[model samples]
Target: MLSAVPRFAKIAAVVVLAAAASLATFDIADARRAGSSGFGSRGMRTFDTPAITRTAPTQAAPIDRTMTPRPQQQPAAQPPLGAQQRPGFFGGFGGSMIGGLIAGGLLGMMLGHGFGGGFGFLGLLLQIGLIMLAISFAMRFFANRQRTQYAGPGASYNNSAMNNANASPRPSFSIPSIGGGTAASQKARQANDEIGLQQADLDRFEHLLTEIQSAYGAEDYATLRRLTTPEAMSYLAEEFGENATHGVRNSVSDVRLLQGDIAEAWREGDSEYATLAMRYSSIDAVVDRATGKLVDGDDRNPSETTELWTFVRKPGSDWVLSAIQGTGTH
Candidate 1:
């Protein structure tokens, strides 16, 4: 009876979780209907499920022909210009916060509920908590997607403007010669005296580097939004998206900031611009998405790698990752 109870509870929990997910999806659809923009400016997506796809109409059309004269029939409202159909929940969730939270919470809760506590009342509570967590994650995800899609005074667009105005066509300045042998001489040299970095500037710059390192390590892209410029963020997001699809993650292990040089510092009308050259090392890892196992061609262990990053800064402003070129040392 006890075993049967647990099995029944497990089935019930799955059904409840599925219902919650459906409810959340329905809420999202309703929200889109209510808004001027729907589903990130994309309409409903195709269903993969054969059962659902068979019944779901590809396009909406009036069923009544004789009752309502064809001439009197109203044409369907058209979507705004340049709008693309949005992907399904799986597509939107894969590289997003909701996906991560759902993956982590459900796995943990399943672990606890399935085996721990001998599948008692506590197990049922865990399952419920897991479902609620998943719903919350989905809600937050939909909200974030909406914000990114529709928020006014868009950060990425603003950053794009700034980048266009601030970024130089060519390398603005070169680093002074660092005294050493062949390898050291190849690196940019640091001047004997201080490079005239303000305390606040240094602090902010370090903070940004740290944030980038953390984000790179954990593959948490949401946090990277604030730490990196739009260009860098877009690049990372693309890499992450590819990784999710390909089932391989490029992980950075150790980030060693060897020498940093303020290659150039100047001011435009309102914003200040500085170009910094930074050298660092990391361990790039590629692993399977399902098994979390290292794939062939990539080192099983963390490998030594080097990178030179160029950052741009504005007055009393945030440090933005501008460029990066890296190489691995096998």
Candidate 2:
């Protein structure tokens, strides 16, 4: 029995040694993902969604025709020519003032009542002052004529551009636009969308965001197909295929949404699209298919990213990821 025990111990030791050697010899690839699969931005965009009708429209956009109210244009600004627009004093006060000054100067020169005699330079000044006084009287007389000529009711100023300032501030809140005007009209819309996003909607989207990332990392194409649109799935598949060709796979874990905001939400026909800006963190790592060694990404470290994701859904249907975009698109 003692001898058999020694033999058994030797066998176990050899097995352990072989296992360690195999582990040491196993190939380890490099990790490439920075703790995540990377940011997505495939679908439409925010802030400038104008002209792109296939995607959801921005809210409060004076441009896109949404359900929200069109923001009224700002009050017409007084043109730069406000002073010019007002009617001048009758008979041209300016013209009379200049004419009288010049005539008096000429008369003074001819009469030798100023610089050439009497008051000298001072006399010239007095003569000009008298001319100005005469001009004032003339101005008053003409002003009276103007007042009488236009006497009807109270003084009324009519401005042609009473309602024409190039453009006004657009509401960024959830107001819908009036109608689908020309696509170009929506370009200069306000910077914000009237995103009436509900808490429920956010929560659902957050969940979907995390799930989709996890599924993609797992190479679970079926789940990806179900959660994303066919177009998105195709892109994802291409990405996966490329990764596979390189003998790499991303392992995503611990996905959390740091923050999220809606760029816009609107119905395009029967389908609704909501473009969201999401700041999220995740632990991701790329592994070598042959060695199960990290090829990229830090599995222990968290990566923070801000991405714009657009989700689309038909009425009475579930929302699926349609596109990914850069952050702050709105």
Candidate 3:
């Protein structure tokens, strides 16, 4: 009974350690950024993946929270009747045999008889290792066979052509010249040809970047409502409410646009939408509401952030922020 107690304690310790490791693996740090993932509407393009650009090469997180209903994907065509089906990793006669072996081994271990009814924990481990080694060998063999089959006459030429096609140059946008009208005009012209964005538009975007940050930090609802769309304002308001609940306030200031480029620009009916990837530095932090003591982030030093901000406007109307997507940066 004393020996059993020690064994049970050891098992409990291992389980606790495993649970801790699992929790640590899935832990994510929360930031005070507008929207960490994609949200809000982007007109008809809400469900479509945005074009990859120089600024944000990785795929932006999909619009998880939006008014737009996603189009249902077409079901894949069924294979022809009686056609031989390709066996999956754990499918068909071979897979069943392997699965049975594994299950039998596990049952043996549970029953204190070990794998194939003899060697105990060490035997179980050895069986698992051998099974894994067999799987690895099988996968490699199949991979090599497929490679050899595809390595026919014009394979090199086909591969070279594919590489060349994939290597097509990405469109480049000129950085807007701050405080210089002439330079801004030239640079804006050099921006994405499809968008037809002007120097004034780029200026507005930069201005809003600073303005919105300041307003959010100050908890100025009026300013936030004026600068952002109704949908966006609601999100900001929600964040503010959450902060108030937590007894903390997000303090943001000293915002400076480091680099920016238009990822995409398109007109949807009466409204025009432009998604810009902007990298900026700001002294963004959280402070205790009551004590005014810093809770998170550096108050003295500014931190850089890269994000995709989508702005919308109609004819003769000023641009307003519609959506903000983080580039997976804190």
Candidate 4:
């Protein structure tokens, strides 16, 4: 009885350790998925946070001028008019089934090969471990392949060579100083102009938000590459890489710009800032690209779910997303 107690204690400890290890692996895998190159074929993008800044003169006129000519420069790349349909959901389920079968077969082989003195208890555990490892690798690989397919072909072209070509020259504008009027008129005009500019900014921001949401839905990471901050870009790239190994893909179903209010807009020294609150949805999923297995759901996907994204605008610069905070959804 005394010897048995010691052995039982040892076994219990091992079981506990194994459970803890599995949980840890699950967390690591989660993080990896966030930074993984989805489906093993995509790259990651970095994400940054909003920072404080000082004020600068608004440059509205040049933006209008540049934007007009810009649209005419290139023909819009339209998807086949009928290409908007969602990919078949069963694709993911099928891929998952296949992965499971492969993993099970591997386990059977391990057990059959005298893994545990006549394929007994110890052998069964060994086989389970082997199968889990195989499944992990398969998921990772399939995820990468699928991600690439969804992201489309040669996305790098959009980020580097093509984007630079499309980028228009910087727009410039001058703000009239609020001085020299019977001080009262000066103040009133300044206030009026600020209100008008703020409204325009809101409109512009909303438009960008809509475009980004559309890009995500279409699995167009290339658009995100240009619009998102460097930090966001890096984070996304890492996420794409890790997920690609597992055949995972993120699909945002909708993004509603619930609100867009100015937080701040100014220049500290040479840098400028424009902070705003953007409430939206980011319906997403982790799925097997080839088989379309739905591995998970994004908290921002459902109609009831919401997310917060912040944008930063430098003095004489374009607005770029700097942060994305989960609004009680993480």
Per-model C-alpha lDDT, please?
A: 0.48, 0.56, 0.72, 0.47
Instruction: Tell me, by lDDT, which candidate is best.
Output: 3
Name the regions of candidate 1 deviating beyond 4 angstroms: 1-196, 296-304, 326-330
lDDT of 4: 0.47
lDDT tens readout by residue for model 1, 31-86:
54541210000001111101101111111111211111233437867888999968
| Candidate topping TM-score | 3
Q: lDDT score, residue 44, model 4?
A: 12
Off by over 4 Å in 3: 1-36, 52-61, 93-98, 109-112, 115-176, 193-195
Q: Rank the candidates by TM-score, best first.
A: 3, 2, 4, 1
Query: What tens digits encode model 3's per-residue C-alpha lDDT throughout 1-330?
Result: 334333423443344345435444432332333345777778888876665555566556667676678878889779899998776544677678766765564444444443424554455445555665675566557667767775874698567545644664244343445534665556545545356877678888989999999999999999999999898888889889999999999999999887677767888888999887777889999999999899999889999887888899998989999888776764
Mark the 10 consecutive residues where model 2 has the least summed lDDT: 171-180
Q: Assess candidate 2 and give its lDDT.
A: 0.56
Query: Model 2: per-residue lDDT, tens digit, 199-264?
Result: 456567878989999998889988998998876787788878998999998888888776554556
User: What TM-score against the true fold does each predicted structure earn?
Assistant: 0.37, 0.44, 0.69, 0.40
The residue ranges of model 4 lying beyond 4 angstroms of the native Cα positions read 1-197, 264-266, 281-283, 293-295, 298-302
TM-score for candidate 3, please give it.
Answer: 0.69
Q: lDDT (0-100) at residue 255 of candidate 2? A: 88
Cα misplacement distance, residue 209 of candidate 1 (Å): 2.7
Query: Taking the tens digit of each residue's C-alpha lDDT, what string does model 4 give over 269-325?
Result: 554444443445456677777887677875344553333344555567777665554
